[model samples]
Each structure stands twice: as C-alpha cells, then as structure tokens.
Target: MLIKVRFFKCGILQCNVVLNEGDIVTIWIDPKRVFLVKLAKGKRLDTDKGYILYDDIIGKEYGDVLKLSRATAYLLRPILEDIYLDLKRPSQVLYPKDVAYMIYSSSVEPGSVVIEAGTGSGFLTISLAHFLGKEGKVITYDVRRDMQETAKFNASVLNLQDRIEFKLKDIREGFEEKGVDAVFLDMPSPWEVVEKAYEALKPSAALIVFVPTVNQVEKTYLEMEKKGFVEIHAEELILREYKVKEGATRPKNVGITHTGYIIRGRKSIKTS
Candidate 1:
C-alpha cells in the first residue's frame, strides 16, 4: 500500500501529528524487537510481519496502531532504550540495567558537566545527555575517529548532538576539561585512566567505571583508592523477565545476567 506523506516538527522530541517524509520512526514489534526507518514518499518497508508503506506512516500520531498486510504494530517515538539497543555497535556498551545505576551513582542531572571515555557507540554518552537536559554538557573521548563519528551520528539522530562534545583522542593523555561533576570510563583498561579521571573531576565528584571482568574491577578499585578517591564500591546487575500469563505466571527461562561490573568512588580535596 502506498500513499502521500507530510511532516512538521512539533516539539523537542515527540508530537501528535503523523510522521512526515524524512522523519525517523520506530516500528515497535515488541519490547525486544523494533524496526527503525526514515519515511520517504512512495517507499515501502518489508518485514517478517508485513509490508509497511512509508505513505501510510506519514501524518499518523505516535502510539497509533497500524495495520500492516500481515500484522499490526505501533507507531511510536524511539526512546533512549530503543536508540541504545538499535544503534550500530562498533564496540560494547553499558546496557540500560548497568547504565541506570551508573547515572544514579554519579548523580548526573540537569546542568551537570560530565566526562566519559571510549564513546563506544555513544550509548552512555547519549544517556548522560538525556539526563543532563539542555544546560548540561558531556565531553566524551575515544581513540578512534571512526567510532567517534558513529557516536556523533547517533547523537544527531537523537537530536542530542549539541549536548555532547566529541574528542578523538586518548583520555589517558589527560582531559582538557577539569572539575567536572563526574568522569565515567568504559574502556578495556580503565585503571590506566583512573588518574586522569581523578584529575578531571571536581572535589566530591564521582568517578564511575564499567568493566566486564572481575580482574578489571579489582584493578580499577585499587587504583581508585590510591588516587585519593573515597567510598569506593562495586556492583553487578542481573535482569529477569517473567511470563505473565495470569494463570501460568513464572520467570522466563532466559534472562539477562552479568553485563558488567560498575565501580564508583568520590574524589576528595587534597589538604596541604
């Protein structure tokens, strides 16, 4: 099925009018499955469920149900979770389960200035920007320019490009921004950059690290203590889904576990 399309930017993110040509829309199949597409005039998207015409999507408000040739789906705005799960991953990322805790522990909020290493597809970088709102800033560093460019593109998709400053350099060489509210490291050798993170953070600010192995967590924790960080702690998160069939309710046999270890601590002022 093909039809004509129209569009207008309603608000900062989501709006009521149907998506227009060139608008990026997420076709939500389920929590675990979603399809993203840039709607264009007279274009059609073929899926296992059915064929979705770009014209049929234009001007439909989000949350409206659409009837495809084979199935029904929801037209909706893509949230941070959708972006994180769907973006092209050139490197591993901190999933929402772990990222939530990291953001909470670091106390990232509106107007907060934060630093992060190894952008890694910009999952965490965009998350921080969402948390900081318009007044805050996120300075993220990555050694590879290609990865940084990918991250920047993802930020643009989320309309958060202005909230982040991407630096194509090694964070271990030291940071250009100082006294930041928080510094987060998602690199393989987070311990190597702990001192640099320490120097970049303000007194009482947080330093958070995410690593997949216990060895990395141990080394990072020790380095945090040695670098004058206090209240150091480490944790891991496991998420399970349950089959809520009313009469037959139980935990799903498959679930998410052991994504990574989060180590956090606070920088303290050095007294003479």
Candidate 2:
C-alpha cells in the first residue's frame, strides 16, 4: 500500500512514497533522519535536502527505501500518534495521555453517547468520535462560535463531522441532551456544570473532569460529592519518554511530565 510519511519535528514537510510490490513497510519513522519522499504524479516537494520527483515513489511498497537529493533515506509509513499530535490546533488541546485515560475509564464503546463541554481545538472530540464509531454520538458544547467553527473544521477533516453535534452555547447554563453514557468537562469551572451533568447522565454513567489547577479539582470534587456522585477520585498523568538506541537506554531528559488532573466519578442512583 502506498503511504504518506510526516515528520513530527518538521511541521511543514510531508513525504508521499510508493511501495513496490512484494515489499513490507515499517510504520514508524525516526524524527531526526532526513528523507526523500515521492509525491503523487504531477506533484513536487521541496526539502532542505533537495527537490524530489513525485513520480519516483509511485509503485514502491510501504517500507521500500527512497533517497532524497542529499542521499538521506526515509521510511514510507508513519505512526498515527505522530500525525494526531502534529495536527494543527486553534487552541490549547488535551494531551493524548488524558484522552486515553478518559476513554478507558469511561468505557467508551461503539454505541456510547458522549457529552463534552468546551471542545477546545476539537482534539478530544475527534478522538471520542472515532472511538464511538458509526453507531455512537458525540455532543460537544462551547460558548465561542469561532472555537466551534474551528472544531467543526477539524472534525470534518477526520470524517467525524457527521458523528458530532456542535453546540454554540455555554454548558454551564444547561445542555440539551439527557441520558448520556459519559460526560467530559474541559471547561475552566467544571464545577458549575456538575448539576447539569448529573441531570444529563444516565444512572451510573461516568463523568470525567479535566482541570489544570489543584483548586479547580478540589472544587469539582467537592461538588461531585455533594451531588451524590460515587467513587469520586482524581489523578494526574505524567508521561516519561525514554530514548531507544543501541547501548543507550534511559528516560528522555524532557518528556510530557504534567498536563492536568482528571477527576472521575459516577452518577449515583436516586432513591425515591
């Protein structure tokens, strides 16, 4: 299969390389290596290494080697995580660490109904929409029209526009949907929406709150407890990356150490 290669470090350069028949391709690329990429016919790519002919890679296998004018070699397929992280965002976005944890903890599935507040940059919204698949629904609310518009563009790019409902309103005042499977709050004062979230979630539904400060977490936890939420807990994730090289194995000096705290709980069943 012909695959496109992108450099995580270099934001501007993308390589389209062809996979010759009967060849196997690795899906990962080293960020530091220079690559010559083939583009579609009649397309050209300019790189610091040199100009590359788009036609050269038309029939190569995914892992086949391609040479740039500078003789630098590059792989054909790049990892999906690299592409996701490199996506352009109009606003600050939730990191993958937080999104993964939310998806796992909430048990988001093919038919889940997910409600999200403050869809900044639409990163988490896109992820959740993908996880929910065709049968699921993702309803996201934001007060800023520009943010919502930008998020719509991002979702469309991912082919998830049909699966998501973008509401240009503040979730703090209220929401339109009820009986949701999961609720994700990424707003500044998530506590303000706790009551509305409780009303919207189905019994025992998971609720996840993302806040950047300890104060916000504390307030949200207190409100959740007051609202009769069960199993209330907060956690922060730190990603420590390690360099993998022959004879050298140690954590990278710098990694995604801290982003924010996540507070999770379930709506308690009300007894009459």
Candidate 3:
C-alpha cells in the first residue's frame, strides 16, 4: 500500500496530520501543474500521466509521494492559487499580475475595509480576502444576479464567504457603506461612479479604476481629477514567462498583454 514511504517508525506517527476522508489535498506533479482532490473512500484521480486511487492516499502523510503508472505526485496542502484555479468564471477575471499590483498600490492591507464594483467571477474579490486576512471585509457589487450568485459560490468553495459580502444592486445606485480604506471599480463607465467612490472612501483612501481601453482610462482619469482626487496615476501590466534551459533560456512568445489599465487616485480631505 505504501508507494514511497517517508522515514517513519513502525509504531509512532511520522507527522502531526494524516490524510483522511473529506479533507482537501493538493497533488503536485511538476512546475505549474497541480490538482486538488477531496479525499474520500472509493474515489480515484485520473490524469494524463496516470491515475491515483484514493485508497492509496487516504492514510498517507501529507508530504508523502505516490508513484503512478508513469509519474509521481506529491500530496501537499492546498493554497490560495489552488482555490483560484478551481473557480467557475462567469466573466473574465483579472490576472494575478494585475491583481497583486493593484491591491498593493491601493494600500489594501490586513484588517482594511474594501469596496469593489461589478464583481466579475469573484477572482479579484477572493484575492482581496486572502490578502486582507480574517479581520478584513470586502463588499462586492454586481448588477447581474447570475454573476453575483456564481461569485458567491466561488467564494464559498474557497471558504472565503465570511470575509466577503455580495450585493446584487447596480453600483450606479451608490454604495451603502462609507469611509472604507479602498474602492475598486471594474465595470463599464467607472467614470460615472467616481463621485460615489469618493463618498465611500475614507479621507486619503485610494480609489483604483480598472478599464480595458485607453479612452475609458481617459474618461475615468478626467472624472477622478474633476472629482477632487489627488496624486493620480495609471499603469498597465504585461507578464511574459520564460522557459529555462541550461543552454538556451528564452522568453516565451505567448505573453499576457493588455488585460487592462489600472488607475489609482486618493480621496481628498476637501471631499470629506
């Protein structure tokens, strides 16, 4: 039953935790390749490389490796990326390269309050919750019921539902909460909500405007300026990964470019 055993004694436990039914595990095969499985009796995992029976992994230590027919996979704990990969995208979600920078630039931190509009697929909202820790809260607004429901389900799957509040009202109606640390707008015509975002944010809080086209950026930027925001800036992120080889390391041809432009501005004390 043991495929590749760790250095364990015959009588005592090798690790503090053991794999059991109803527990989620991350199966690691290679770089950028992983699978999440809910361990249960009589269940099996099939992959192009090979298949793994749950019976083999049910009692194994988390760090143990299991040999398949043609490959080996390591049993490890799940992480935020694992949860992100498993989301059901009802709309185009923001890339991690952009999400990380946007959150960091907006000064969103642990225990901070955030408000975001047009919660597309909940990827950004989920990322915010993960970064903000348990003491933080995210209020996400979406106009469509279906999209909001899907986002709620995705957050629940990742066990982040408690950190987020899903609202199905149009963001143009204005947000209910005020004095938040940050406000993120991802919907069309974020320019229309600039004043509303200004009202919701605390004094000197950041407002991030995300849009797909330069024209939209211009419109949003002008509105932000006229709305009395200060220290405004905009940026676009392009991520290109590289294939590493001992002799010929080169950048990959397929790079994620032009996902969107992120514009940041701070709420002015004059507005408060």
Candidate 4:
C-alpha cells in the first residue's frame, strides 16, 4: 500500500511537527480490522495478534508499520471518516453516505462559510471544518449545552477547535450569521426554520436539510417552495456493501437503506 506523510501546525507560531502523543492515529492489522489510538506515554493496546506499548507509538512517524508476532500493524494518518466512525457519541450521527452526498450537493468546499443546525454528534461539523480548511469557518448551533459540549470535545480531539464556532442557542429563535454561503439543517423541525435559513444565507446560496422521515421532508420542501427558494429538490440516499473474493463476490444482504432524506434548494434572488 502507498503511504502518505501529513503534518499539522503545533502552536501559536504554527510550526509543523511529526505525530505525537494524544494525536489520533490509525493502526491497520489487516484488510478487515483497524484500530484508532490516542498515543499516550503509559498506555497499552492489546490486540488479538499482540500488545503494543504506547511508548513505542508515541513518537513514531505516520505510514510506518510495526510488526507483531501474528500480524503486521500499519500505522497511518487518520482521515475524517476514520475519526468519525470511531467516535463514541450519545447522539445519532449523519453517516458517511449521507455526509458525502450532502457536501457534494451543497457544493461545500474550502473557503465557504457554512452554518449547521442541531450539532448532534459533531460528525458533520467536523467534516465541514476539514473541507473548509483554514480559510473558512463553520458556525454550528445547538440548544442543549450538554450536546454542544460533546461536539466541542470531539472537535478538540481532532484539533479543530478553532475552525468551528459553537452556538448554544435555539434555531427557532434565529441565527446569528447573515449572507452566509450555505446552511445545513439536521434538526427535528427543519420546517420551522426554513425562513430563518433563507434569511441567513446569501442569495443563490444552498439550503440543505437532512430529515429522517418523509413527512418532515415533505413539510420542509413545501416550506422552501412557499418561501420562494428556487431549484428545490429532495432525495434519499441508499448504500450497499459487497464482500469480494477471488471467485466469490456478492452484495451484503443488509445494507444502509434509509438513514435520512435530504432537502436542497437555492435561495431565490427574486423576492415577491
């Protein structure tokens, strides 16, 4: 497998450094199993093949492999998906399947200011922060302080605390940002805030809503249309996995069928 080396800024001066303790890393045992570790000086990780001391991994470079008795562990840099999937959060997250599409359909990229509602697990917020890079910012709002705390902690784990601004306010009340590039809604009552989202976004900016039920989708879509949002669309994403072998390959019987419905629309430049 090809290896890539990555570096991140460490301090106020923004000096780059190698991987260190508390940095999240991916240890691959095989094609099927991988482990996410936060390197600490005194910690130990025991796998089926063998145990590894954190001291051995704390200062090691990414893309390096440590050979154990029974398996070869490949240490690599962790991606957004890797960190997100391994997260232990109390709230239900937007899966990778949904996230990928949401980013694509909404045209979220580097240097785009984005607003996100209902920061449940911070998965989506993290992804937005990553894609926005250093040039852009994510303003995520949530009502519950506890949930916001969870999301804030997750952002800190990935060293993205500065990129996201967490707002502990109710969306129904209103949003702080105006003329933003895009808005993402993952809340229970997205329909209730469509007008607010329209006001927050810049003209021609995208308003994307993720809902779990068809009724919510219907209500949100109608609200967008009634509120004069153009280019309206609603979609459901389904993903299936397949097990492949040299001669045997088949789709997994059970797959991710329906996680949520996405409602997308562009803020209308024409107003009645």
**Which candidate achieves the best TM-score against the true structure?**
4
TM per candidate comes to 0.89, 0.80, 0.86, 0.90
Clashing residue pairs for model 3 = none
lDDT of 4 by residue, 1-272 (tens): 32222322321222223556777777888856787777778898898899888788765677678888798888777766686545668988998889978988888777899999999889999888888877889999999999989899888877787899999999999998898999999999999999999999998899999999999989999999998799999999888899888789999787888899999999987555
Candidate 4 regions off by >4 Å? Answer: 1-18
Q: What's the lDDT for residue 195 in model 4?
A: 95
Candidate 1 lDDT over 1-272, as tens digits, reads 43333221232454455566777778886665578666779898777888888898877867888887667889876655677555778887778988889999998788999999989889999889888887899999999999999999888776678889999898778999988999989999999988888888889999999999999999999989988899999998899989899799999988888798999999987665
Top-scoring candidate (lDDT): 4
Q: lDDT for every model?
A: 0.83, 0.75, 0.83, 0.84
What TM-score number comes out for model 1? Answer: 0.89
Least lDDT summed over 10 consecutive residues: which range in candidate 3?
A: 4-13
lDDT of 2 by residue, 1-272 (tens): 44543222112245554443222223222465433332346665565666555466556544565666575544555432432533568787888888889889997788799999998888888888877877899999998988888888766644468889999887778889989999999999999989999999999999999999999999999999988799999999999988998999899987898899999999998666
Q: Which stretches of candidate 1 lie over 4 Å from their true place?
A: 1-18, 30-33, 40-42
Per-residue lDDT for 76 in model 1?
A: 75
Write the number of the candidate with greater lDDT, choosing between 1 and 2.
Answer: 1
Per-residue alpha-carbon lDDT of candidate 3 for residues 1-272, written as tens digits (9 for 90 to 100):
44332211111234445666766678998866688776779989888889999989987777889988788899976655675555689688888888888898999888999999989888899888877877899999998999988888877665678899888898788899999999998998999999999999999999998899999999999999999899999889988889889999999878787899999999887735
Decreasing TM-score order of the candidates: 4, 1, 3, 2
TM-score-wise, the better of 2 and 4 is: 4
> Candidate 2, after superposition: displacement of residue 146 in Å?
1.5
Report clash pairs, candidate 1. 18-59, 18-60
